[model samples]
Target chain A: MIEVKKLRKSFDGRTVLHDIDATFYTGKTNLIIGQSGSGKTVLVKSLVGLLRPDKGEILFDGRNLLTMTSQEVKELRKEIGMLFQGSALFDSETVLGNVMFPLTMFTSMSRAEMLDRAMFCIERVNLKGAENKYPSEISGGMQKRVAIARAIALNPKYLFCDEPNSGLDPKTSIVIDELLSDITHEYGITTVINTHDMNSVLGIGENIIFINKGHREWVGDMSQIYTTSNEALNDFVFATRLFQDVRAYVAKHGKI
Target chain B: MILTNSLANFGRYCMFLTRTFSIPDRWSVFGKRTIQEVSKLGIDSIPLVIIISLFIGAVCTIQMQLNVSSPLIPSYSVGLATREIILLEFSNSILCLILAGKVGSNIASEIGTMRVTEQIDALEIMGVNSANYLTLPKIVAFVFFMPVLSVLCMGTAFIGGWCVAAFTDIIPVSRYVYGLQTMFTEWYVWYGLIKSLVFAFLIASISSYCGYYVKGGALQVGKASTDAVVSSSIFILLFDVILTKLLLQ
Candidate 1:
């Protein structure tokens, strides 16, 4: 579990995150949802040590991330895995090579052992025969799956995905979402996803935090999302007629 | 303001080099990458080196023959002058300036594209020292192969001059070979090789630095590549003068 306390970040005196406090539980999918320009990206970047917050305590299972030394940070990063929005696979490496990279860099595994582990990851992501193909040879959905496979190759304690569903079709987005949810539950990894995809929010948003203009507007699970009294989140999440009718039906039937 | 910014950039460049010289996390990976880079940056440049050296060598011979044809000037002076020009300047400094355009821009654009596409971020998130992992092998490969390239450039240039003498009425091949052999201070070759090594390091590191810190998107990457070439060329010329004064004096 990761605990954030009074996280404040600013750039050139313009505050991006204003004294934010949140907890991301282990073995759960923690979704940070907001419109564009919200501080969700900044928050995630700070959590992963990509950006430093001006003032706050980011404790990863009781260890303060800010106070850690450079070496400590590096040691901690080996236990963390991230899936970039663009599925930032090395353009030069094939799928098998990409999955084997972290193992090669971090572990003492022999070549055959690394290959076996990478093959297992590929199989887990359902990309069995595509190991020899380059990232450019695959579709965006496949690339995301490759990224997911690469992310889990090390079986990290924490997993961060930055807009994992962006640029993917609805069907592919659901697949990616379900995969993330399954992985989080299976490995007991503290999985945090930054996304504005409402389908993701309503589908597998086990613990959702809605941010509005650099502030946490609401916090709830899917069960309580429609019954929330937050106007901003309602306007943003249930803006479409389809969602509004669903909200009406949920209100009338008291069901999801 | 401009001076302050320049100072800051220089400081940042120093810091970047410091980070880039760390011990590799895995020696096997380093070995593999260095070999790959030697092929990419060094072996691939052989054709360009041969072509340029040949043309310059032939031009020097022709120009020296035309200008030094007077009775007061010995017949061997054309060969001597061409040899001096190729050995002292063209093979080392000029070649590096040319490569500062080719290899330097290539490194800049490739790394800059990686930066814009978040590949570097991905590497960093995986706890890899992205700077060292990406830039060190290129620097090592270029610096290590520079002496070989210099020797090859010198040999190919002499061959070019030999071709000119054998085919044309500019000068006799025997005289040119004799002039090349005459008063050939082996230290000059060493000096050129040393200078080439420094220039190669400059080209690789400066280009990598330009690319590594690239922000924004495609336009910024294009600008960084241009900046890498221009900056490396300028530094190569500057170092050529400094090294010549220091080494020759």
Candidate 2:
């Protein structure tokens, strides 16, 4: 579990995250949802140590991230895995090589052992035959799966994905979402996803934090999301006609 | 304002070098990457080096022959001039200037594309020292391969000059070879090799730095590639002057 306390960040005096506090539980898919420019990306970047927050206590299972030395941070990062929005697979490496990279970097396993583990990850992600293919050889969905396979290759204690469903079709998005959810539950990893995809939010968001203009406006699960009383959250969740219809049906049926 | 910005960038670059020069987390990986970089940035560059040196050597011979067309000047002066030009300057400094366009821009564009695409971020999050992992191999490979390239360039240019002598009525090939052998200070070759090593490091590091800190999208990556080539060329020329003065004196 990761706990953030009073996280404040700004850019050139423009506050982006204003004294935010949140908790991500283990074995759950925690989603950070907000519109574009709502500071969700900044929050995720800060959490992953890509960006330093101005003031905050980022506690990864009680260890303070801000106070840790650079060496310690690097050591701690071994237990952390991230899937970038663009998948970010090394263009030069094949899917198998990509999956084997973290193991190759951090493990004492021999080549055959590493290959076996990488093959296991590839099989787990349902990308058995695509191992020899480059990232460019695969579709976006397959690339994301490859990214996921690589992310979980280490069986990390924490998993962070930045907009994991962006640029993917609806069907592919659901597959990626279910994969993330299943992996989170399977490994009991503290999985945090930064996304605005409604299907993802309603489908797999076990613990959701809705940020509005750099402020946390609402915090709840998908079940409570449809019946939330927050006006800003309502504006965001029902912005589309399909969601509005869902909201209406939820109101009439008293549940979704 | 410009001065302040430049100072800031210099500080940032120093910090970047600090990160890049750190001990690799895995030596085996580093070795593999260094070999890969050598092939990509060094061996692949051989044909271009050969072709350019050949043409430049021929041109140097022809130009020397045309200009030294006087009875007072010895017939061997054309060969001597071509040898001196190729050995003292063209093989090392001029060759690096040309490579700043091909290899420097390549390093810049590749790293810049990785930056814009979040590949570097991915490395960082995986606890890899992205700078060290990415840039060190390129720097080490280029620096080590540079002296070999200088020697090859010198030999190829000599062949080109010999070809000019053999084909055109500039000078006899025997005389040209004699002139190349005459007063050939082995130190001049060492001097060129040393200069090439420094220039190679500059090109690789500066280009990697430009690419590593790239912001925005594909356009910014292109701009970084241009900046890398331009900056590397400028530095190579500047260092050539400094090294020439220091080494020759």
Candidate 3:
């Protein structure tokens, strides 16, 4: 489990996060949803030790990440895997090489063993035959899958995905979300995803935290999402065309 | 304002260099980045180096043959002249200019893209020292590869000069070889090698720094790449002059 305590972050005197606290539990997809510029990315980055919080502590299984030495932090990093917004695969390496990178860096596994592990991860992500292809040669959806394969190669204890479905089509986005959710439950890893995709929230958001203007506006599961009384969240959720049509239908039936 | 800022930046850069050197794990990272950067920098730059060195040598020989008219200065002395010029100025300065355009731009753009894409941040979060992991290998590669490339450049230029002299009948083959063997000093080769090492350090450090500090987005990375090549080229020429005066004295 990842626990964030009183996390405060500022940039050049402007506060981006205001004492936000949240817990990302294991074996579930915990979603941090907010509009652009609402500090969702900053909050996730701070939790992962990519950005230093101005005040607060991030405890990964009771060990404070910020207080750890550089060496200790690196050891802890072996347990964490991150999927970047743009799939951030090494352009120079083939898909197989990219997936094998973490294993090569952190483990003394033999070439055959490493290849087996990498191939297994690639097949797990459903990218079986694209091993030799470079990132530029693959489609955007395939690239995201490759990134996921690379992320899970080490079987990390914590998984963080930043806008994992950003550039994909809706169908592909759902597939990616399901893949991540399934992986989370299968591995029982602490999974935290930063996204504003309503489909993701409604589909696999076992636990969701909504941030508005750098403040945690709500924290609950998908069941409580549509019924939340918070006007800002209501405006956000009901602003969707599908939800708006449903609202209009309910209003016409005098059931709103 | 620029002067003060530049001075402060220089101070900060010096501190960064010192801190980088002081780290205990510097050698390990240097070894890794060296192998990576050498294949990317040295092996990739060979064709351009050969083409440029040969053509420049041929041109210099033809020009020298056409311009000089002293009987005391043998017509075949063009080979020796090409050797001296290539070893002293052309290989060290011109090759560095080419690398600033090629390798320097590549290093900056690659690292800058990594910065914007959060790969560097990922590395940092993973407990890896971004500087040691990214920059040190590049520095080691440049330092190790540049001197060897300089030697190759010199050899190619000398051969090109000899071929041109033979074709143009500017000098007899025996006289050209004699002039090359007798005229040039060992110091000149040493001087060029020294200059190549300095040029490599400047190019790699500045280019990597440009990439490392890139902010904003893809646009910022493009800007950093341009800045890296431009700055590295200018510094290479400036340092060439300073080192020439200091060492050739």
Top candidate by lDDT: 2
lDDT of 2 by residue, B1-249 (tens): 999998998999999999999999999999999999999999999999999999999999989989999999988888888888998999999999999999999999999999999999999999999999999999999999999999999999999999998998769988888888887789999998999999999999999999999999999999999999999999999999999999999
Each prediction's Cα RMSD? 1.8, 1.5, 2.6
Tens-place lDDT digits, model 3, residues B107-154: 999999998887787666555577767777788788899988999999
Candidate achieving higher lDDT, 2 or 3: 2
lDDT of 1 by residue, A1-256 (tens): 9999999999999999989889999999999999999999999999999999999999999999999999999999999999998999999999999999999999999899999999999999999999999999999999999999999999999999999999999999999999999999999999999999999999999999999999988899989987789999988888878989987998899987
DockQ of every predicted complex: 0.85, 0.94, 0.53
- lDDT, candidate 1, B1-249, per-residue tens: 999999999999999999999999999999999999999999999999999999888888888889988999888887788888888898899999999999999999999999999999999999999999999999999999988888899888888888999999779989888888887788888889999999999999999999999999999999999999999999999999999999999
Share of reference contacts kept by candidate 3: 0.56
Which sections of candidate 1 miss by over 4 Å?
A244-256
| Clash pairs (backbone) in predicted model 1 | none
B1 Cα displacement, candidate 2 (Å)? 1.6
Native contacts present in each candidate (fraction): 0.81, 0.94, 0.56
- Please give the ranking of all candidate structures by lDDT, highest first, separated by commas: 2, 1, 3
Candidate 2 vs candidate 3: the DockQ winner is: 2
**Winning model by DockQ:** 2
Q: Candidate 1 versus the native: TM-score?
A: 0.98
Model 2 chain A weakest lDDT span, ten residues long = A242-251
Report how far off residue A25 is in candidate 2 (Å): 0.2
